[model samples]
Target: MARRGKKKGRPVSGWLVFDKPVGMGSTEAVSKIKWLFQAEKAGHAGTLDPLASGMLPIALGEATKTVPYVQDGAKVYRFTVAWGEERSTDDLEGPVTKTSDKRPGEAEIRALLPNYTGVIMQTPPQFSAIKIAGERAYDLAREGETVDIPAREVEIGRLELIETTPEGNSIFEIECGKGTYVRSLARDLGRDLGCYGHIATLRRTEVFPFTADDLVPLDALEAAAPKREEAAPEGGRPFAAQGERFVALDAFLLDTGEALDCLPQVAITDDAAAKLRLGNPIILRGRDAPVQADEACATARGKLVAIGEIEAGMFKPKRVFAG
Candidate 1:
């Protein structure tokens, strides 16, 4: 009997801005993309609920290292709030917990927008991913346990009412910093307006440097990959022969450097890049002499070398990237 070895996928790297469709969990979307690309490693910057869709930035191979940077960036979302009913999850997925018929008028909704903008205290939905006592709050909530999510300060850059419907539904667009939950916003707004509400529809339009325009639908990505015929005798998977034509997964990848676009760039010499790669700091020179931001991307010949901090006239490598 022949011993079969584990199959190792290709060492693909870079970011894939996926337009995650509704009804699919973020984890499921990442797995599907990973398999389609046959990537060695994959991860997503943030989790978009199964009920919500759009702009999920997936990181493959080395790009996984930059997930934190993208996750911390600002996000924009457009959602609809359905008045007259409140759900346990704050979104349509959960059971209805309360009901009311008092829908806020357009004038009242506009006035309330200012109260939510800027920095304000927000209590995350009970059925949320937040950790409580080392377990997910949602898990506790589902088990019929009482969950009290405390209020925390979150920054909302902008919150505007887009439209209102006579059927007790309203659409809104919000630009907010990391950690802000749209479900919580909907839940609170209803309380303030004397009407119960829950998120009827939700879609993330932007996540930092990536926008809806950058997203590649799942179907398109699947079509781009070459179809595999069958498992080869040599333990390799063979792609269907297409007469002198083949598409490499790398063609679909955006440079990993794009993930750090929000950071200021500092060009460095080959020697400096080599030093940074070795987890060491390099003193800046010329126009790059004075660091403009506390943190900056150190690049060599236009390729990212490391993300580091500027202190004492030196760029100290905090996170080194594989070039």
Candidate 2:
């Protein structure tokens, strides 16, 4: 057999906190980010609907291993609900399936907030990524088939009514655990208040371990890309413009260990790091060593070594990292 050639693209690794603009799908953003960086691998921590915009943490190369950490983190969204219309898709993108002239008073909305602020059962919108019988709910809905999407418990940490617009819209912000749907919140809120509603504007401001402050707009990122040279150098291969650009973009990436920030960290010596890399357990020594931890990360000389479970005073590697 012919020797397998090296995989294409750079092995760039880190999180790019992207401020994804509206109208761009999450998968599309990941593909573009990968191409721009010439990365060998890329993935996103959470999915942001094309209609929504904000903190989308795109992980490249080794950072992809930590995606679950960010996905499990709480998310914050600021959204506006337009009263008098309930759309089939639960947002402005869908056609209005129901409408009512009745509008919700600010007081009525404020009173209802308390009822939604906590753990509650919520039915996801018809046009969601939820799978039913191995098929996407949205695909079935698009085919004009109504799927029975069962309600499930979702935690709403905070729900605040920021302001009610005179145009018959209410702006609210929420910090919610994973799988909470803002569209469902608006739809259910309207039903309780005797006013049909749909999401008019939605923006995700934060994903745990990242915030609006870390966001970089698509335009800014495109502008940062290096301009490519027109021709190859004489008697030599073309100048590595793509490689140079990769270096330039690398500046924007957050450290891969940043994704594991929520987990407790333990510093390990080179000897211990070597053992962990070989899929062996290392005994935790010293008085300050943790007796036990359900999950924690070990670092050696400021570099991540492994994420593992501590049991019986030994750290058993679960996922090891390559430098």
Candidate 3:
């Protein structure tokens, strides 16, 4: 779909997934891409901390509206935990406040991981984006206040100890539902093995079809501005032509598990174009009135443009797809 304009604030719509590198937070990565593309509308589906790297999905233009659905997809990660060291942040970025003389066995460690699978409650580390009262939990902790973060339910479908070392550290690959904290799992694994532990390394391997293989190196984005522009045909997106990537908006919406297909596609009737241009919500008619209302949906797809629902019945122009 073609973007609605050459004016300011309109963004080219599509999905841009990157192999984020360690030490760059998800927001920073998204910001870099936004600046490179010169896009005003962009945001990431999930947050990967500065200490970790891997598949980071940045939604641009209309795709940004689909963040909740995309970010909620199951995630997989490969990580390493250092034994004998406990950090306040549950990662290397934290201060090492504890140590252990005892080493943990691999046999004992495997037994504890299963207990974490399925449903469990977790307290956010003092260093997290969760809010406590009016302030972010991490901010409160940074101020030296004791952070009594609340425990909330999260699901861990699979967390296997991929490997281990005599150094007391362990490597793991995890598949978990949204909101699961791998850092906490690493820390708890350390505890279960009778030693303190912290996450020494982490890399997200997958978020749906996007994987580590598709990720661009963090160093690539950090290079001094290149004189040549990397033009993305669909959005007129200009960024360094490294491993940067994109997925069409139509495919993005249809692929979402949401049952958008159930709704009938209504033609932009001559009477409707003005309203559509004004960005008003309108119900589409199907042979079955009840079904139309029940599946209330809207989409406008053409040469380089695809706009979908802003809400139930409301349609907004999303992106202008390049041919």
| Best candidate according to TM-score | 2
Estimate, for each residue in 1-323, the C-alpha lDDT of model 3 and write its tens digit: 88786444334556667678777878888987776555557888889999998888887665665576567778999999998888999999989988998777788887787788888998777888888888998888899888888899998888898887666578999988888888888787777777889999998988754565545554555453333344333465333222234222122222221212333444545444555555555454555323223223333442222344434444454422221
- What CA RMSD would you report for each candidate? 3.8, 2.5, 7.1
Model 1 agreement with the true structure over 11-78: per-residue lDDT tens digits:
66789999999999999999988888777689999899999989999998888989999999999999
TM-score result, candidate 3: 0.72
In model 3, the worst 10-residue window by lDDT is 248-257
Between prediction 2 and prediction 3, the one with superior TM-score is 2
Q: Summing lDDT over every window of 10 consecutive residues in candidate 1, give the lowest-scoring window.
A: 237-246
Give the alpha-carbon lDDT of every model.
0.86, 0.89, 0.66
What's the true lDDT of residue 313 in model 2? 81
Candidate 1 to truth, TM: 0.90
Q: What shift in Å separates residue 276 of candidate 1 from its native position after superposition?
A: 2.4
Q: Which stretches in model 3 have alpha-carbon errors above 4 Å?
A: 1-10, 218-323
